[model samples]
Structure formats: structure tokens, C-alpha cells
Target: MADKQNVVSVSDRIPALKEQRKKRANRRLIFYLSIFFILIGIVVYFQSPLSHVQQIQVEGNYTGETREIIDQSALVSGESIWSQSLGSAKERVEQIPYIEEATIERSPDNITHYCPRTDRTAYLHNNDQFIPVYGNGKLMEEQSLDTYPSDAPIIFNWQNEELLEAFFVELDKLGSGMINHISEIHPSDDDPTLLRLFMNDGIEVETTIENFASYMAPYPTVARQISEPSDGILHMKMSPYFEAFNPEEYAGRFMKSTLIRVMVG
Candidate 1:
């Protein structure tokens, strides 16, 4: 009777072990199926357009047309954000004239940000049109003079582009008050190295291109010494002098006369 009872206990233990093994197998199958489904979901999300770039936001652009800059970037909607090289994109965008620097960034919401920086130093007047000139003296797009009325000085007939660039570099050093006083700058018909400046206060200045800023620095102080509605020729080519004109007597002879060549500096 003892041996029979022992045999029955051993048989029951075997069935219990089998049941535990089956439960483990079922759990493992469920876990593996769950993992497989999650992997499929990840793959689907990556393959769909959800992971691609949908929009581009531009900022910090002043001279460049925002739409034109974006077009030049070569970054289009539906491009894979993960694969697109942001460094290369920035390089392409900076290639546009007047764009001194550029920065690019991406967001998780399928959007890209492009920021461009530039310094609009001056404008060149050619054929009755105004072209934007950057601090580096590179010419940007041209627009009608009427469309863009500029307080910046207008450069005229500067055939030597190299010299013009250098002149602009020097001009940028002057303060805004002095810069605003200048209305027109033209290369002297007598000497290309010399320039004639027409001031908004009706004073004409003649100086070498190299000495433009220094010679014109004291113009405001000198101008105040004269009476109101002053009209004169401030010659700075050789020595600082002012030739005042009697509005009635020298009305037409202003440019030809050296009558009141009084030394000011």
C-alpha cells in the first residue's frame, strides 16, 4: 500500500511540472508578439511622411527677400529631416549675396528654422535705381529709386569697383549723424581719386576719397558758425577752407568761383 501511494504522488508531480512549463511557453509567446507589433509600429512611423520636413521658418533676415532666400536654400517640404544635412543647407543659403551668415536648426514637429544675418551698409544709385550694398561692398538686388527712398548716401559713377569698396569701408566708420548729412557722392570728373560730396544742408565738399571721413568730421561745427540757409563750397582737397557765396551775386557762379576761400581748419 505504501509503494502504491508513492507512485501516485510522483505521477501528480509530473503533471504539475508540465502545466508550469506550458504557462511559461504561453507567456513568452505573448511577449514576443507584443515586441514584434511594437517594432512594426516604429517602422511604419519612420517610413511615413510624418518623419519628413513639413515647413520651414525663416528669421533674422533683413536685406534678403524671405521667400527668395528660402527658395535658394534647396530645402523643400517632404524631405527626410533625419537625412538632410543642416550644415550643407546653411552653406547653400549663405551663398546668396548679402547673406553674411546663416544658421539652421530642426524641431521634432517636422519643422526647420533658418536664420540669416547681414549688414545693409549703403546703397548705390545707378540708372535712377538703388541697389543695396552690404558692409562688404557687394551689390545686392536693384530696386526702383521711387520704391526705396534711402537716407543713405548715393554713390555715382564709381567705375573703379575696388576703390568704391574701399571708400565704403571708410565711410562706415563715420557716425550716423555725419552719414545722414551726406546726400550724394560722386567721383570727381577731374580726378577719380577725388570725390565731391553734396550735403543736405546745401554745402558742397571736395576731398580726396582717402580723406573723406576725417575732412568731413568737423562739418557740423563749421556749418553752425555760418548763418542760416548757408550755401558754400567747403574745399578739403588741399587745405580746409570754406568759400561762402552771396545767394544773389553768385547764384550761378558758385561752382566756378574761389572768392571766399577762408581757411577754417
Candidate 2:
């Protein structure tokens, strides 16, 4: 009786072991098949248009400059968004000296966003030809425009790069009110460091580069005090004072030339 019970127990254990092995085999097979299907799906997803960049957007741009910046970034439509080296592309965009900064972002919908912060442009006037000078003091010599910008000040004889760069920095400090009123800027013949600024309202300003912005800040106030359209040169080197332009020389030039007073600076 004992031998018969033992044989029955052995038979039951062998069938249970075989069932567990079968279940393990089925799980492994399912896992491999799932991995294969996932790989296939990944390949299809990459090959389809969904993975490619369909649109590109540029923000905070003026003129055709942003377009050129985007082109330099090497970001284009139909390119794989996943494959693009965004950090490198951004570095390339910022390579332009005039561009202060560049931001690049990729959207989940396969869109590329690029924003390049370019410096405001000022004109270096040369008679009929006007060259663009960026706020960073980069003078674009190759490019020239015939028309003069009424809103911007025209810089004259700014040959020295260092001084011109410093002058541009001073220009950055001026507000639109003062900047728009300024028609021309030139270095003094006797003292090159001393600047002569011609205002559109007909007032001439004489000051050094050190006091440019601060001296020009009170222009509107000082201009209102004078009765004539143009009176004399406003000397702001040490302090604000007026030197009357000999009215007899330039007619319709200075409004208060009636008094030929010799005021020594």
C-alpha cells in the first residue's frame, strides 16, 4: 500500500513541473514578440512625416535679418527634429557679432522656434551713402543705403573704431526723444574728443564723450528756454552755457544772433 501511494505522488509532481515550464516558455515568447513589434513601430514612426520638422518660427526680428540668422542656424523644414543638434545650431546663430543672443526650441508637434536678439542699428553717414552700424559697434561696410533715416542720428567722421564704439555705447544711453532730435554727430576739429552734435530743432551741442548722454538729457528743457529756433552752441563740457553764433554770418541760421556778445568758454 505504501509503494502505490509513493508512485502516485511522483506522477502528480512531474505533471505540475511540466505545466510550470510550459507557462515560462509562453511568457518568454510573448516578451520577444512584443519587443519585435515595438522595434518595427519605432522604425515606422521615424520614417513617417510626423518625426520631421514641418514649420519653423522666428520671433523678434526686423528686416530680412532674422531670415539670414535662421539660415545660418542650419534649421530647416523636413529635417529630423530628433537628429538636430540644437545646442550647436544656437551657437552658430549667436556667432554673428550683432546678435546679442539666440534661443532655439523644438515643439512636440515637430515645429522649430528660433529667436535671435539682434542689436539696434545706427547709421554711419558718408554723404549720399549710409552704412549700418550695430549697437555692438560693428560697422557693416559692405552694405549701404542711399536713403537717410529721419528717426536715427547720422554719425560723421567716426573713423576711430575705439572712439566710435564708445560713441555707440553713449548712443545706447539716449532715449528716443533725444536721439530723434539729433540730426548729426561729429568730432570737434580742435579737440577730437570733444563732440559737436547738430540737433534737428537747430541747436548745436558741444560736449565731450564722457558727458554725452547726461549733457543731452536736459536738451528739451534747455531748448525751450531759448526764444529762437536756433541760437548758438550749447557748451556742456564743464557746465551748460550758450555761445552765440555770429548771426551775420549764417542768415536764418541762429535766432538770437542779434547780440554779438563774446562769451569765452
Candidate lDDT scores, in order, read 0.73, 0.73
Error of 1 at 11 (Å): 23
How many residue pairs clash (N, CA or C atoms closer than 3 angstroms) in each of the candidate models, in the order given?
0, 0
Q: Write the per-residue lDDT of candidate 1 for residues 51-126, one digit (tens) a residue.
A: 7888887888755478877777777778777777788888888877677778888886454545555466567877
TM-score of each: 0.69, 0.76
Q: At residue 108, give the lDDT of candidate 1.
A: 61
User: Which residue pairs in model 1 clash with each other?
Assistant: none
Q: What TM-score would candidate 2 get against the native? A: 0.76
Residues 1-265, candidate 2, lDDT per residue (tens digit)? 9999999999989989999999999999999999999999999989888888887777766656766777878877887778888898889977665676777888854545455454554688876788877666666665678987765778887667777778777877775567778888888655667788888888787777876788778778777766775456777555576777665664432233545433332
